[model samples]
Target: MRSFFRGVFVIFFLMTASNWASASIGCGDFLRDIASPPDTIEFVGCESEPTKQGAPLTALYRVKGKDALAAELYLDKKMGVTERMKFVCCVWEVRGETFYKDKKTGLGYHIRMGSEETIHNKREEWSKIGYFYITVVHLREPL
Candidate 1:
């Protein structure tokens, strides 16, 4: 009787623990990718528009609390081209990572990520260190 009860208890604990663990990882949340700044939090979707100066196409994220654009992206006139992105909020320590690749088209999203320390730390804030553009350029050098 004791052994059976103990096994049942273990199984129940395992089930509950798994649900809690999954919720904490932020895997259910998605990051917003380019035509926007690197500092923008990853979300399920991001919108785009031509900027006021009218050069690079900008990717923008609407931050709920701030009610403003969190990041901006500069895109080429043509599709699937290289980009320059500026981060506006709560992102520091950026690095480029190749998240996807295509065998046929040879196009992929080379993305920037914040360091673990910075990513987890600055959740609800804005960017601007020394009042300069926190920009990342995604371009491959000449082959």
Candidate 2:
């Protein structure tokens, strides 16, 4: 019985580890790294309160890279702030690559993509690199 239990424990551990290894950020993981205060970086998404009745809404994400360098991505939407919610953008670093993905859209858009340099100094190198904004639209009913 003891040997059987040990085998079960080992299998459980391997399954958990494998699950973690398979997770990938569709857009990238840059935003994830920035959401935590303790993190060396930070990302925030903001949208203006709807003003005009029919005016298109816009969502903006501000990614503050290390050393205070910052970049912004904007998305236009048709939902109100109450019906739709935006979470802190996430950034992830993997294999020397920096990736940015919208928390809401998951892998739907690639707001920013770069090598190690872009992640370290986004403010200065964003234009030179391929920094772009990703917008995601949801069709959930209003709360």
Candidate 3:
């Protein structure tokens, strides 16, 4: 009986471990290292809010930085991770745009290389990197 119980325990452990390993981590983990330069990202937090039909809407990170940078990440239900990233490039309406695509490495990035816009104009960009939905917004700092 002891040996049989030990066998069952081992099987349970393996099953649980495998499932945990296969599970995709939340978006916050993907954004942990990301930073919008001049302001360092110190914390990456995640939460799920109640939505319609009892379904939870996950806001991977709703940042409220203290003397730092704050931002939000939003997902488009109609777009896959890669498709959403492609859309980001088209929406970037900077005066001078530099876009880079790397099919071999599956990495894409762009830089808004143009004249600065007026402070009142909202500057926002969205993209996906890996499993992360990234949003970069330039806004007037709140007093």
Candidate 4:
């Protein structure tokens, strides 16, 4: 009887612990919470990259849509989350990242963002939630 009860207790504890771990806030939550545009649109998926310290970092949880529009929406949602975390929004002169592709075979690609822009911004604006970092970007108004 004692061994049976112990097994049951262990199972219960494991179940609850796993649920709590998976319940951590993620970029998908932000994408789902926002009001959708008039037309039907769906986001590809949420992705997380590890920071220098191996902390989960979500840079741009964006949908497949107009680049400028998606960027603007991402910035807005990120700002709201940061504010809720008691952090101020850190705007930058430029906030968008660029990707480069090799011309020969179009296989190689390079991703880069402004270092000067993200340095202060990341430190000041990034909010920590259960070892995850929400990296926000400034929405540059279309010129």
After superposing candidate 2, which stretches have Cα over 4 Å from the reference? 1-30, 33-38, 48-106, 113-143
Report the C-alpha lDDT of model 3 over 8-83, residue by residue, as the tens digit: 2232222222112122223233233322222232233434323322112122222222211122221111111222
C-alpha RMSD (angstroms) for model 4: 19.6
Kindly provide the TM-score of model 4 when superposed on the true structure, using C-alpha atoms: 0.25
CA lDDT, every model vs. true structure: 0.26, 0.26, 0.23, 0.26
User: Any idea what lDDT model 3 has?
Assistant: 0.23
Worst 10 contiguous positions by lDDT, candidate 4: 108-117
Off by over 4 Å in 4: 1-24, 27-29, 34-42, 50-54, 59-93, 96-143
Q: After superposition, how far is residue 135 of candidate 4 from its true place, in Å?
A: 7.5
Error of 3 at 68 (Å): 11
- lDDT of each residue in 1-143, candidate 1, tens digit only: 22222222232222222122111111111223323324433343322222322111112122222221233222232123233322323333222322233333342322332221122233344332212122121122211
Which candidate leads the pack in TM-score? Answer: 4
Screening candidate 3 with a backbone cut-off below 3 angstroms (N, C-alpha, C), the clashing residue pairs are: none
Q: Which of 1 and 3 is ahead in lDDT?
A: 1
Per residue, candidate 4 scores C-alpha lDDT tens digits across 18-137 of: 112222234443323433322223343444533312223233232222232333344344332211211123222222222222233222111211111122334333322112122221
Task: List CA RMSD, all candidates.
Answer: 20.3, 18.7, 19.6, 19.6
Model 2 scores worst on lDDT over the 10 consecutive residues at 78-87
lDDT of 2 by residue, 52-112 (tens): 2211122223233332223221111211111111111222221111123335444221222
Candidate 1 to truth, TM: 0.22
How far out, in Å, is residue 31 in model 2?
2.3
